[model samples]
Target chain A: MGYEEAFPPADMKWAGNAAKRFASPFVDVPHDRIDVDAIILSHAAVASGYTIRDFYEKPELGIHCVAYASAMYDLLPVTHWFFSLPWVTELGIRLEYKDTLPPIPAAGQEHVLKDPSDVDKIHVPDKNELDKGWTLPMFKRLYTYVQKNLGHTLVPISYGFDLVGAAAELCGVENFIMWTFTEEEAAKKLVRKYTETAVNGAEGLADTFGSAMLIVGSVLGNNDIFSDEAVKMYSADNMKYYVNQCFRKGAGPQVFYHLCGNHETDYKVFKDTLMWSPFTVIHAGYKARDPFPSALLKSEFQDRATCMGSVDTKLMIAPNPKAVYDQAKKQLLEGRDSKRGYILGTSCETPPYTIPGNIYALTRAARDFGTYGTW
Target chain B: MEVIMSDAVKELIGKRGLKVADVEEVVKNGKAIQKKGTNHYIASKMIGDVTAYAEYDLESGILKKKANVTSAYSHRIKLIKVDKLDEVSDYVMGSTPVHNATLQMEYMTVVRSGPGLATADGSVLMVEEYLATKTLAVAEGLFEKKRA
Candidate 1:
């Protein structure tokens, strides 16, 4: 209902468990169970029986719902929506909120940048604009409350470190892709602008948030957009500059890579390139539309980083509980024995409208198969 | 969910320079409409940039089943992943016509220690054969002692 009801300041047991659950893969904190860090968005409402409109209008409800639903379903982690919206908001993207859904990009919000030279189209957000929404002022307050009162870190960047995708979003996709070859220097300047904003903005608030988790949701870095050659020789090469800079600059305490689309060609390029934080968890999304199996991730990544296996959002949205349970079981069995540790997660955000039974199915699968040493 | 990888299947993956992750992608993304009759599903995927389709049914990088051959690669020399870096390093050192053994080690040190994915530990690699070939010779000319 409000920040006071969001997370209890006295709940050290809950706080410690939640902290260890997320920190387990990277640290020896003794949390060995397989669980979900679903990045549950408005979908937090889907699990808690609240309307999506309520989550956005009163994000504390979303926070409460996350805790409520996570406990209800025995899910081990929770995420907030504030980490994402400001990226679009800073781009002058208008959002139209609805009664039953999170805000969507308003119609007629044209791509803001006309060319690579239109570098002035975006700017680094100041602390005030960090919550630039009719209702978003609450996030700044809630996050501050969470950290100071609850002793927890709140920010995990979703779309940060994605220099290529962020730049493309500003200009149109085709224009940005063409300029990578035709106007290379100008394009790099444009990408560097967004990269600096993402990195520096976090750095500026380092004392407040304690640590920024630089998560790279390189959505546009998917194989469909560029050849393995061009992506390797170009896109990934360009973005790695910022990635190295993120590490070299000490932008965060950890880095999470959510390669959000088909990466069959792109992963090879990334596998041998790019820096990873010790707490790195790479959750590569579906290929074409199928979830990237966890077994492949283990073979490919070894113990270099924790590999998270995902259940498709599509399957979760369906009413078929058995399918969700089966898929979750498959992913849990495959990844539960990973040498570097494994997490069962949704491919992206668990869709806000996903049916309740399907959401419960993930918890059921975890109990049946994800308990440590069973595999 | 069940796609078997025999030794021959693994070799097909290795020779092409791909990883198990790539095959998982191909299989999962595919309709897997069991061929009208065959056990092998014709796994197809859309290629990057270029309007084309590429098939990627690579084996998982782990060599659980023994193989007569080892190394894994991608075009222009990127390692998808390798079972034994020593085996691949030996081939590059003893064979590759680019340079002599001494020069090769010097070059590889520079490569592994440099930047990007191929860290000194050598779990996964980013090999640059063509570029390194030219660079190695340049280094040799600049540093190697002239025979009296």
Candidate 2:
């Protein structure tokens, strides 16, 4: 396959604006628009009539989907590919795929790490060996595609599947949760194993793409789905401590905390420990399905983090773009003056078939109501 | 100007978000009432007025730092004395306390860490979180009676 494909000139004014927002969020630079990301992937594929299977199987199509969707919707702070299977599939778990559905681990599939003791099997793929896998080659092509075609410095973000949360999927999720309470020693040992994979994976991608905004997400391991006591026993208390080891191993300056769960119970765990990067954007998910109050996030994290506003993902699927616009405007109003910084985003990934009008409305609201302030 | 807190107490306190700065300020300036006869001192209620019953070595009339300043009550209830604020945080965090006992005896540990008082009915609490379970009015009352 020829590595080069023909493309037209892309509008990159949004990239420059986003770069300024990232570099000096609070500096009084003349930025008229705040950065907005729609998590616009599945919709991009749909625009091209390419299914979820094609995006993963055709590695080259991954960048094309992100590019087409980001440009189609004028999404800022452009991202390359985003999917969870590239991570889970490597664990020897069987995956079920369809035209409409993203690759998901098959139900009742035997977990590769069937027991906590099997944690010893999780070897971190060294830096050199990373590209031999499916994820890195796509990353190489993405960076090359961005630089070669657009002459733009695309900051491809790290994949969002956090190590500790992904580790549970490696060993059946239920089994791992039970082990945290019943077999404490074994669970912590597994944590170290997953931390290595996570750090090595980030190091590998950054090596491939030069630099990236490391998105360390810890959601499936949060207290809402898990118990508060167990979260302390393992996820919050242990995962955070081990993940910080990435800094010592050499990571990028920016870290995006995809804290995508109801954090009412364990917010302190993150407030106290999770943030280690100089440039941090903390994405708050929800408190009981409604958007976690942006004001509360601002209050707790504004001193140290750029709080991302959670425009509800359900709104993205709403027939009317006005619903998405109103939600984005509400988030912008409360989150705009966050002392540290603010970026508007959906509560999480916008569902696959989310209408394009809703995506554009999100950006329109961002420009209409976004903070027009110093850098 | 002279507050003598043992290194163990200092280390334990550090775990509860008390920096050396806060401890020095509270110890030097905060009122420390000696726990009756024990060398330990109960400093003025701090940290949301939860009343950290600092286990301290009392020097004459001065408040000196010690550990488990509440052995005074755990002394009576047959519960092990837990004067360390870290243990208070641990217990609040659902950690098994130093001494395992029946639920009744467990509640008996209602924080004898000096500043706290275990009531006749065994209902008082000192950890900041437990204080919020009551109404604002009742919470303020609990706050007032938090320190014996």
Candidate 3:
């Protein structure tokens, strides 16, 4: 194989934007002089994608830039790679970060009919006033703008799988779970509401970006926030409902599902979902004492899908490069036996604070052990 | 802003959803009523205004109050202060006050950690189970009073 790509392209201006939005304390590389093989356009405003394109277009520093778009499954900022077309290489989304979040659409542009039963459960206080149906058009505008101005692929976003957290946020976690057992009818109706909106959004993306894939997104692993019962009731069936209705019917681009937790329990949900075997599974962590081996997924879906990084971002910040190198080696060795489609990467988003030498070490490990033959 | 009630008085006040102040009013009723220490053998006159009271019963499980209805009664009936909010919360099983009534209660204990109740200190509560027949009797009497 060849050398694997290092994200946070050296030339891109993420620092200034990071500081502007996140109030990052450290200075980032100047956008004009940054260098990178590709760009993972995080889930943010329009300027993020443009900044990456401009870096590559500069006459002084030429590089190949791929626009990795975030999904719209929830309010969080995370990307989902939903295209199989050769022009858009699919790099899976991260669970720890945010997703592409556009402000709720303006009201009256389109009628967002609510299922009769879900009228009371819709949290947006004035549901009729929000532009629920116009997400597709706005996205189309974003795609058209990016493609025309920057010449990048209009990857249809696979958004809106963070329903578990969304539900918990709207209703406290204890009450949400309590509602399922106590208020059975109301709970079922709420789940149906969440699933239906997601399906509608999926149809919108598919309709706009015809050659696009669906990304089932989730933040299922926040202190077991995706409680077993919550997962069984809300996540499992709702995902099946949306994917079958919206994603499965679409043409072009194999669908991908992105999860942000260790996913210790939902592995079954991941393997069995109707979407195309994922193009990439990002951020499944590897712990030293996890009862089962990390290699288990390799045996199961390695041939069917691509496995992204497994090196824990926390482990990479060790004082020396050797520790980073050692951990990366361990991950490759564990994964090498499966030897199908493998992309050596961190178990979660590579934190910006990661040491550069360690980042280089990861690139080296992917080159060294990410190959098909003997390590 | 203080509300206090004994286990027996609180139960007479009903459990659906009542504040301490509401229970306190019932204990200090002006009408002549049977009072046995913390227990009130009979509370002939419901103390709080109808609007302030969430219709509920002290027995027949907490689930009985899931519905709402209103009835005017001119006469008062007898009630035994079998248990109060503190004693009921103590014996109610499971994680919540509602769950306690649903689950078995042989080994249940009252919440006693003073620092835990964010609203105040010394805010411990209890729960207790009456004899099986009295369970239904108390529930019947509470709803009976609702009609009167």
Residue-level lDDT of model 2, residues A327-365, one tens digit each, is: 888888888887666788887878878888888888888
Note the B-chain TM-score for every model.
0.29, 0.36, 0.22
Better structure of 2 and 3 per DockQ: 2
Worst 10 residues of 3 chain B by lDDT: B110-119
**What DockQ number belongs to candidate 1?**
0.01
Residue A328 of model 3, lDDT score: 70
List native contact recovery per candidate, as a fraction of 1.
0.00, 0.00, 0.00
Q: Report the Cα lDDT for residue A208, model 2.
A: 63
- Model 2 chain A weakest lDDT span, ten residues long: A21-30
lDDT per residue (tens digit) for residues A1-375 in model 1: 445554434444665565566555544333646767666767777555678787786665666666556655556654455434335556566667777656666678787787666765567565455545332244445556545543343553323645676666667668888887798776766666666655544544443444445666667768878777756655566555555555444344355777777876577776555554334678878766688888887777645567888888888888899998899899888888776678888888788877878878887887788876565
Q: Model 1: residues >4 Å from true position, as ranges?
A: A1-3, A6-18, A29-32, A82-85, A91-105, A120-140, A148-162, A178-185, A233-239, A248-250, B1-148
TM for every model, in the order presented, reads 0.64, 0.66, 0.46
**Model 3, range A1-375, lDDT digits (tens) per residue?**
111142233222432332222110001111121111111322111223333223322211111222322111111112222111110001111111122221222233321222333335464311122224333444455455444433322345545455554443334445555666676666556556555555555555555555344555555423255554456556655654555455333422233444555556655555443233212333344333231233776765554344443666665556687776777766666664543244455555444334556666665665566443344
| DockQ of candidate 3 against the true complex | 0.01
Query: Which stretch of 10 consecutive residues in model 1 chain A shows the poorest summed lDDT?
Result: A150-159
DockQ for every model comes to 0.01, 0.01, 0.01
Q: Give the candidate number with the greatest lDDT.
A: 2
